[model samples]
Target: MKYKWKPVLAAMLASFCLFSSPLTALATDNTVSTIEDEMVHNTEGAAEAGSAETQTGESETPVQADEEPGWPSGPSIVAESGIVMEVSTGTILYSKNMHAQYYPASITKIMTALLAMENCELDEQVTVPHEAVYMEDKGSHIALDEGEVLSVEDCLYGMMLASANDAAYALAIHIGGTIEKFAEMMNERARELGCEDSNFVNPHGLPDERHVSSAYDMALITREALKHEIFRTVSKTVYYEIQPTDKQPDLIPMSNHHKMICSGKYHYDGVFAGKTGYTVVAKNTLVTCAARNDMELICVTMKTEGRQVYVDTATLFDFCFDNFKKVDIGSSGTEGEEIEVSVKEGDSPEKTEKIPFRISEDGYVVLPSQAEFSDLKPLLLLNADRGPEVTGAVLEYLLGTRTVGQAVIALPESMIVKPEPETVQNETESEPEQEKEKEGKGFRWWYIPLGILGALAAAGAGFLIVRRQIWKYRWRKNRKRRRSGRH
Candidate 1:
């Protein structure tokens, strides 16, 4: 009975294994499939995320390239309008909304000083007007009073160094007769200096909706002002001692308001001249000039908040000095050898002569430090009356579409060869004689023989006629004799 029960139990266990094995295997396969689906979904999501990141990374490639070695990514500046210009070449190195107009504040005195240097003698006396001294209630001034006398030079120092509104007004009134007239003169001079978007409503740059200038226009005005020796001298003055005026008995010591020029904290090694301007409306406007290794740069920053103006200007100067260099495109004393041009309709159409042209002046071009001469393209623009003797600008060197420098196309005074006038021989006189000679030569040798033969034939015909006449006569004579004999 025990052996029968053991066999029955073994048979029951075998049946249970047979029935559950397939179900268990199916459940395990379902679990693996669900996990694979989850893994596939996660992999697809990760790939999609990676693809988006790659697209974003590609857009930022240029900025990354600018940060690479030897490549300069310009410093971030907070100024609303700024420009860095090369003084010698007038090449703008960096710009941010440079043409947008903003209030000039005290930087207007750069033009004021320039006009004073141009129109009046430095030692000439300027009588301060009451309106000029009292024009601005809340602005920088040197405490000038009515009928106070100061030289043009002293007023320029006062205006530029101290950002004195009164000094600027007095100088303007002296030069232009009235403030409105001076404003007109300022606009005219600004146009002459290539400032297109500048308007001066007041000489002191007091806040007015009409009185505004762009960073680019102010840079142009500053560049022109720097050309004047007196302006340069007065602008760089850190401290100037003004002699006691009739209105102010105490000696008024004026110091430049520009930190880069006066204070040591923001001062730079090569900073030579600068002007500072500020108002509640026009915040922290600054114009500065610096020189390093003979390369001069002018930096103008406008609408900057707080002390960032000086930092922005100094950063611009560093960028220019680091990345750019002045290349001498042409030298003044070195004249280009004469270029030969063929004269088409002159005395000798086949003749070619040389035109000796010199470079107009020593022309410099500001370019990247790594730039080469091969990057420059020379375009020769011949004059409408272009000839060996015509003198003017012959060719211009260009970097892309910009004209970098020019060469004077002129005939040398000593080497100018006037073309000889061609003699006009009379065609009527010479042509007929040539035609007669040609006609004589055109007669053939056979024509001469034919003419002789025709003459001989005519003579032979005459002889025949004479013989016939004789024969008739003889025959008549014979007939008469015969008749007589018959009778």
Candidate 2:
């Protein structure tokens, strides 16, 4: 009877598993939310072509002895176009269709914010115009009204943290008088930053058939943007609030739209700043900046499918950080440590200063972990990258024909013997200011102790005088008692 019942129990157990399996699978899948839950993971474990590829998602490739110079292996990502660039040296750590143009949705605000930061001060007041107030109600905004007054800083927070399209327009109008003029400034600035694959038509990145930018160009723009202290502050902010404007009566609160920064599900360590964007036409685009292992890297991925964009960014960051290291190639700052150069400024025969030509302090090269600092080839040039401060030399560091890094041979700000000030005011006005500074700090090292001793001496003299007076008063009282003869 027991043997006969065993098969029956087994059949029931199998039935239970069959019914519950779908429920279990559904629960596990729900952890991935919103766009990611809808994303088709077709490109998982595959690299979109034309990249020096590695397996996606935390998979690492060891540096090979025979790998090409200055190129490290990067991960397979679903982004249609992407690149990983070291922020300091501007070295291309990873590449995949990097220069290919695509519509760059709201990531366009990076340029808008950059222009605002460069052109305007934080507390500068900006007014909301009619065009900005009347944009499509469907686009992101804080419901600002026409003639609303807010500072440039408030507009920046709204644009960056809330992805507000209206703020971008207002900022555009404030800086360039109109969006059209502002976009021209954007393109001009893009060109100045060496962004060859971009054209800016709008500040808010609303879909226009003519609007387009490339991943490489976006990366370059971001790299330049990060140089400003305020830009860094805006990008990394998780939450912000704007005081009610003239049009709005309530305080407005905002959370960063960049999921990698605010959402714990996709949070990555060392990812300090990022911008996220999407439109039906542009798909998902992302730019993130992270610092780890002494390397600040910018990762730009455009036309990605969904949450995989975040995954792709993290994977690339890990790959670069795990495989490469920054090798310092700066001047040792010691005698015989630098080559001597003759610098004759202004055709003045007064002095042809023999400046010790040393590599700039900012000179550092990113190389594969297997490579050594000794492997870099140094070449010296007479060109002054910085026109005025450069004592007339630029040291170019190369790794097998690739220009890995360049350093300006600069005159130190505190040259034990500095060159004369360039301007007449600087030469004349600086002397008195310097003298005043010297006078302010003049050998007052003894003043503190001397004042303390004087205070103590005064207190001691006061104490002795008081004691003498008290003793005299007591003797007088005793003498008066003796004269009375009351005892």
Candidate 3:
């Protein structure tokens, strides 16, 4: 009984399903997408807003000799090596001899403060070594006696605010185990931040001929340092007091030497953090970080005169902040959809393989206020062309010669379009099949149409025969009536 009813139940269920409304999950649209659309938006929200102002490999607008708008030359100052870099994008806004090597003076403490914060806890106590107590202290010092102890937080505040060499050395020794080992750690860190032309032999920026760095290198270090919460807090501080320690009694008052942060005559509106340095040989060196209009700027000036370093930094910051604005590339046209570029097929030109990619919305280029998005150039780095900086970035955006930002392009291996293999047939071996195909073409389905026409004709003939028979019968009856009348 169950077997017999199963088929009937199945048939009824099938009928219900066939007549029911369609599922809502199958909806879709067919709008054409741009290159920005070719790359699918990743979960990290990496996509441009909508930059239709680009060609396949270049900017949309053509640049000519006379019409090309170059990057602005910031106000000139006495600093021999100076640079203004945007923190987020790592864009070099205004640069003059930025690569030249110069003594970094006391600004080298920034690295020491950063490493201490990273390696030790804020409340962790750091012991002052015997060397810190009696070591050459002609430079700035908080006068730490031997066996004196301070927390990592206190040391950072003292090192950054007072530009204390003793505090820097103590933190370095505590973190790296020795001053020489700490210097090695510093060099290693500098290399990690892409500082190509820098070497550190001491924690303090004392005039070691070998201990030297470039403006570019220092800015790079500063950018890396600002990532730490403690570094950021200490760098911007104007004044801090070190309370009585176990080895010392009186309070140690410390004040920041940075004119901008100290509210000196050279104070600028957005200057939050800075480190000042001066040695007879190095002259005056300064590193400043400022923020305005949602953008952070790091200005490094090496080998400048007394007050001119402050003047140079402020000028450069004002120039960059006033003239430049950030613009997104490969932004959101339609999110989650990829724009594909079909460049090549394996070995044959006949077929093509399209690779799907998306430009990271996180990537942006700083452009001049008057410059249009079309003026920015996009360089897509594929396979072998990718470098360390572009490891996760598929595109590098440039404003003239300077790199403004990079695009986080997602190129999934699963999404690669490969050419389908072709199946070839030998003409001789398939001759019989070819002949059969030819014969089959000739054998058209004429029977269906002809049979339909023949059935219709037969029906019409039958109707005519019946009508004739009826008419004959009627004629005979009429003749009989006439005969009867004549009789």
Candidate 4:
């Protein structure tokens, strides 16, 4: 009976494994398939929503989702691509497929606006070209006529507030000579702004498969754009009334599509500037900057369904603002402690000298609000090959794998002594003696002069003794000769 029970138990265990193995595999496959489906569905839904909104010229209010647990313990977001970064430190606080490239849609105007501000003055007049007004019928526009006249300032407002496609083209052509060249400039500027996965095919983000940018890249562009006063002013404007232009003579009332900035539907108190973008292919994209308690943050969300773009961005901001605090990692000179570096071939190679370095700029690290100086682990990495005279970033302070801040480890101007020209060796010295002399302790400066003086003294003494001997020989010879003469 015991043997029969053992067999039965073994048979049951085998049956369980046989059934469970396929079930486990099926569950994993379903999970992956579901994620893929969700991403595709989100993209398709965003495209439909954007198209519907553009057709109706109506902005949708964002529906807020239930708040999850605080960051690091929160539920996953629905955005296909998103990122939250510190404006000052460029430290990434939260990211989901941040580097994955997505179409930027109308957010492309940010770069166009940036180039306009840089290349044209606010008062500069620009003529709307035929190409500017000839966009697809379905695209957003402020109804600029061909050859219409507007100031650069007005164009920016029209483009940003209303996401006007014609205004963007006019500004681009005016600043960059042609749409092609303007796109080139946009790409160059994107590279300069540290955007890696981005390409600009046109000034207005219409759907070109070639025009793409990543969430991180868009954030980088937004960061640079925020630096300009005009950009900030234009982006934050809710309703800008464009004065009647020469072609139409009717005043166009433009409203910002960014509900966060215009309608204040999902507005957070600290939101200063935001840009909204949408396209059938690119889906929905958004970039916003917010500041709280002196910590500025930039958030970008892409390929989200309906109002989820706004909801996702708001959630990211909330998570970051609630959980993270800007900690002054302290500036380079604040510590007042100089780093002692062993400089090879330095003036005092035997003894290390203290290099006074200041953090290139005041650095701030974003950490959990509860994080303290004790929790921060700083590693000082010195460039062993760096010259003593070169004053630049010599050591970087890192927290874990991330570089929290960098200290410009520069040798003081006074300490940067041109290494004494290597003592050129006299070719006359033997190799062994040269090696001995190189040891520095082997010979003093007085040794050569002392040796010369010793040789001169010895020669003089020898000359004097030889002269005395010659005189003695001459005297003896004269005496012998005189005695011989007497005999």
Candidate 5:
């Protein structure tokens, strides 16, 4: 009977556990998930509130294992030296032997144009120097006669549009006083622009052993040049007409050698402009641009084995647009539930303002869904003032992550921010006065008490010392007297 009852009791307890266990598990799971979501929300709040802009790569998630590379043609274009970079962010999307040194050939003109545009005034008159009219017997030439006068602007069009060595030489002399000096300036500018493995023997990229540049360095130069509006307008010119001069009266008809400039085969629309170059040694160097769906890509290929430079550039552009996209990092266009940050204001008595950030509008380079923001850091560009009508504050922002391209954070325009009534504002006009009053009261009350206590302690210590001395003196006198009596 006892064994049978034991079995019955065990069975009853098992049935009870089975009935209650599911409910208990469901509640625990829900609570854990809520806590997790709350944590994620708080962290993301820092990110959305623009405070996270101060944070760096540590807070970002790891990229997926099977994530797609940024460029669509990343795997397709195989050249001795190549790179595909985002136009706005200057982020490298794809690369191969990019840092390897190779003759830049005419692409050296890109830097030449950059220097010339800033230094030589467009309206300044230039006379062809004898030294520029004649260079080492090799390389392309526009054959300018010595002492011929032309506007500095015409010479620029000639150097860039015709890829003429003579124009490049003339421009260098006009700006630097000599070709050798100009070359020094070019090398100096290269160092300033962070081109570590570059040297310029001449202003125009003729195949001098000293006139060599790495694909990476050329890309860096081009990236900087693209910042100038003149370069974009000049490099992409389909036809340029140099004014007729006394020496050569025929209006020089200049055409861009970049095949994409005229060829309808490649779909390059935003290719506002780019330079082309080639030499037997350099082997078909090409740089070009294109836009698709509002994203512009700059492709650079140097030292290729064939003359298919335009085709390769097009392929690279297509690969990037087809594969990658720009993602806004902050509150600009984030998907799912909206993330917002609440700021307490002081000067302006306005209440809390909700700022939402999204992904698309923030200008971040995003790969396919497989890719995640890896090693991301937020850059906050903020402005503040100590006076009313605060000078136009710019909340400029920037974000960088490994897998995603760098994102530009657009700042809010200058506007007054006010504090919510419920929230405490640290900007109390009476703060100093209140602190002074408290300090004065503390001195009158607790400080007086402490001072009295300290004085008593000192007096007590002095009394103990005096009592010990008196007892010692009395004991000595008594001993002396006793010794005297004994004697």
Candidate 6:
């Protein structure tokens, strides 16, 4: 069934870049350092497509390769963990080791960006803190001097585009008054977004064992963050120049670390924004967006082998866009069969029946060929003579073994019986002959009086009938006398 979502996508992909060798390997490659050069080289073609298509030969890269080629032959590709998701539906197309824990590294900035947009006004000016500037021990840095003041918007670009640890810390401190407090907010937001295996130690996603999240959790976080218009815009930006502040005379050039933004091969037609991360441990992690024929998809890859992560994620996207389709899987407006139900204690014993109805429309569900229809369970809330009265009965519809939608079945209100005095009496045992004699005394005394009244009424009615007959006869006799007199 086609469900119209209220502008919401699930939190499905996110990553972090800690400075660990394993984690750093994914981010330090040619993709990260040469982003500016690539963007300039492909700016002409990319501009025509409005940032949807990346540079040449890099569009819609899949997260991981399948066990065998030619088709999506296996479960969603995975090195350490990965996910292929439909962007518009937030439905996971493929996943492997998606729930496995890995450092989110810079991908943690996705949450930072989300929290900043939610908590702080974009116009709010923040003073860069000494602590934010001094996180040199952590790998990523924007090199913001202490006491520099910048707007929340500029810091956002720095955090998202440059993967700046300083910008993340500064934004965290500005919004929450402390990095620890901001970290708490991130964790709380993660939990609220249903990131079951995610935790946060720092806003910048530096190397801290405490800062860990699974691919599934990362996807969940990404899905949640992408709903915000601000986050979507910021994450996709290839380059932005932060205006000069009072202390800083030069404009800081912020650039997107994700190559999919500039690579022509994997650039989708509709991908607005996404995030990327790397650490030696997390290894070449990427979360990307793509659009085709108005359908958008998000793919995540972590711990992938060499350059294939991009290719795998792209393949997953193509498979999803090409195979399954969105369809309205709901019932028709007109009522279907009116099922007859028995009602007890009806006025007419033979007419103890009520009608309930089910309505369905023609539509199909979008799923892989291997998918099957889930069992349909009748949600009948019929009013029986038992417990509490079942007032509103309905049958919810199911899709793929889940209650994706519901259809209401109206029960006849008048069909329900209220317990009468005789019904209550039937439940109690009757007394024996002595009690019967006691009952007979009061009934016997009133019976004669009631019988006399009934006889009087009947006699009165008989007299009225005789009087009417006599009146008619008198009228006919008068008419005869008048005729004789006239003769």
TM-scores for the candidates? 0.64, 0.66, 0.65, 0.65, 0.58, 0.59
Report every candidate's CA lDDT. 0.73, 0.76, 0.72, 0.73, 0.65, 0.64
> In model 1, which range of ten residues has the least summed lDDT?
33-42
Best by TM-score: 2
Candidate 2's residue-wise lDDT over 88-199, tens digit each?
8888778788888999988899999999989999999999899888875336677788888999999989888777888999999999997889999999999999998898
Better of 1 and 5 by TM-score: 1
In the range 1-487, model 3's lDDT, one tens digit per residue, is: 4569888999999987776634322221111111100111111122132222221213332221112348665665567788888988898887777787888877788778767767889999889998887874336678887889999898888788777778888888899998889999999888888998888988878778998999899999999888886687888888799999667898999877777877656788888787877665786789999999878899998875456566667778888899998766655352355543333223434322344556544666777888876555555444433432233335566567667777766655653333333323454558889899999878568988999999999999999999999999999999999999999
User: Candidate 5: where are CA atoms >4 Å away?
Assistant: 1-73, 264-270, 328-487
RMSD of each: 31.3, 21.6, 34.7, 23.1, 31.4, 25.4
Task: Kindly indicate the candidate among 2 and 6 with the higher lDDT.
Answer: 2
Query: Over the stretch 366-481, how does candidate 6's per-residue lDDT look in tens digits?
Result: 44444433332333334345435544444443333433234444455764434566655754535465577787776457789999999999999999999999999999999999
**Candidate 3 residue spans exceeding 4 A from truth:** 1-69, 329-361, 382-393, 412-487
Task: Show where candidate 4 strays beyond 4 Å.
Answer: 1-75, 331-334, 338-360, 374-396, 407-487
lDDT preference between candidates 4 and 5, better one: 4
**Residue 410 of candidate 3: its Cα lDDT?**
63
lDDT of 4 at 59: 49
Give the alpha carbon lDDT tens digit for every residue of 1-487 in model 5: 3467888999999999999999999986654332211121223342234323212223333221112334233554434677777766666677777777888888888888889887878888888888777664425656678887878778778877777778888888888998889899999999998898898988877667878887778888888887877777777777888778787787777766565665555436667667777665675677776666766677788765333455567766766777676655553334433333323243544244443333334355545434444324333222234333342222222233343344433333434333344344444646887998888776355778899999999999999999999999999999999999998
Count clashing residue pairs per candidate: 0, 0, 15, 1, 16, 64
User: Model 3 reaches what TM-score against the true structure?
Assistant: 0.65
lDDT of predicted model 5:
0.65
The Cα error of candidate 4 at residue 68, in Å, is 20
Q: Can you tell me which runs of candidate 6 are displaced by over 4 Å? A: 1-78, 87-89, 330-366, 369-487
